[model samples]
Target: MLKVKNALALISEAAKSWYSSNPFQFSAIIAYYAILSLPALMIIIFNIVGAIWGRDIVQGEILGEISRAIGRETAESIRMMLVDQGNEKTSVFATVVGIGTLIYGSTGVFFQLQTAFDRIWESKQTQTNEILVVIYSRLKSFGFILIIGFLLLISFVLTSLLNTFSKRLHRFLPR
Candidate 1:
């Protein structure tokens, strides 16, 4: 029982050390995966467009049609409509991709936490309870990304406000 207690303590200490040392890694990873989500969004849009138009985008030269649809517009209204639609579609595609990436990437930290606990608790003589305790000990470490993301959002809002304030202050200050 003493050995078990020592093992659990070791695992707890290791988990604490890891989380404290690498607090930002999780946020960085989440951000990286979030950025990569662009491809996923493009693929989704490509499929949706193909389904709606009854054409295989890769083989059918769909962009040509889109270009033509905009080019053939003799009226200003038609040109504006085409341009607006294209822009809207592109924005939707990007948003879908980003959200998809964020959601998928959110699971990565959990898997890492699971692996860390498994390694930390894997004694030849250890029982399941110790392993479970180790896993629970590390679960909070996986939440670093979520916390960082929230903080980043708050910072972004604050930065935007600061930019506005700076602009106003610039008008009052000499160059």
Candidate 2:
């Protein structure tokens, strides 16, 4: 009985702390940044994975998954947006600026996540250079994105191999 009461009190305290952190507002902020970041994130991932597979295959797999999660209509809209972004032709300066923008946008969600985590953990940093800190954080986030792209590519290749193996195994076994 005492253990149960102690557990309940601990749970209640944790809940109050979580509620005080304003999780819903943080979630809303993260979602907004994610929406803003999606195009750039997709473009980066497509570029990374497309080099190994093909853009069409990567796009098809990504869109198919998105369609399943959301809907075909939303996926189609995303495809259109990606197409438009790909088709744009720009001058050297504009291209540089666009690339910078894409990197910044792609890292936005991760940056927000870092902020939320810091807030939740009540971490205090004693940094002399704010700009450097921000730069480091963004670079870390970009590295994470690159790792995700690589993992996604590996996953696709592995899945394809597994499917082929499964079919061959079925031929040898009684099913």
Candidate 3:
């Protein structure tokens, strides 16, 4: 009985803190930035994973799986948005501008999330205006992106192995 009461009290406190933190506004900002950055984020991960397996093979398998799961039209739309072909004749200057936008867009959600954390903790650092702190926060967000890429690559490898094994197993089974 006492433990249950304590647990409820803790949850109540946490909920109160979250409620006071302008959660709706914070989440809206995060969602907006996430939509803007999804393409660039996927492109970065695809490049990292593509480096391990052949790009063409990986992309084909991924697209096939996506199409199977979410219908061909949705998968094709996402592919067109995210995957840039070298033969598209994109301008070098435009590419540079896009890269700059990608970095900023990807970090925007993390910056807003960090601000929310500070609000919840009632953090008031005197040195918050330091340039180093700003750079560190942005790098911290980039580190998260790297971790996500690594995890995605691992998922792709594991799923491919399982798929290959399943096919071989199916051949050995009764019709």
Candidate lDDT scores, in order, read 0.51, 0.92, 0.78
lDDT string, candidate 1, 37-125, tens digits: 43333343334444444333321343444456655443344334323443444577787786555544454444454544454455353
- Whichever of 1 and 2 has more lDDT, that candidate is 2
Candidate No. with top lDDT: 2
Residue 74 of model 3 has an lDDT of: 84
User: Model 2's lDDT to the true fold?
Assistant: 0.92
- Least lDDT summed over 10 consecutive residues: which range in candidate 3? 81-90
The TM-score obtained by model 1 is: 0.31
Where does candidate 3 stray beyond 4 Å?
A: 64-71, 83-93, 124-129
- Comparing candidate 1 with candidate 2, which one achieves the higher TM-score? 2
Instruction: Give a tens-digit lDDT track for model 3, residues 1-175.
Output: 5698899999999999888887898788778878777666767667767888768776787788789998999889977765754447678998788777777677767776887788768998667677877778888987888888788778878987999999999999966
- The TM-score of candidate 3 is 0.79
Per-candidate TM-score against the hidden true structure: 0.31, 0.90, 0.79
Query: Residue by residue across 1-175, what tens digits does model 2's lDDT show?
Result: 5698899999999999999999998899999999999889999998899888998888899999999999999999988876677576789999889899999999999999998989888998778799988999999999999999999999999988999999999999998
Which has the greatest TM-score?
2
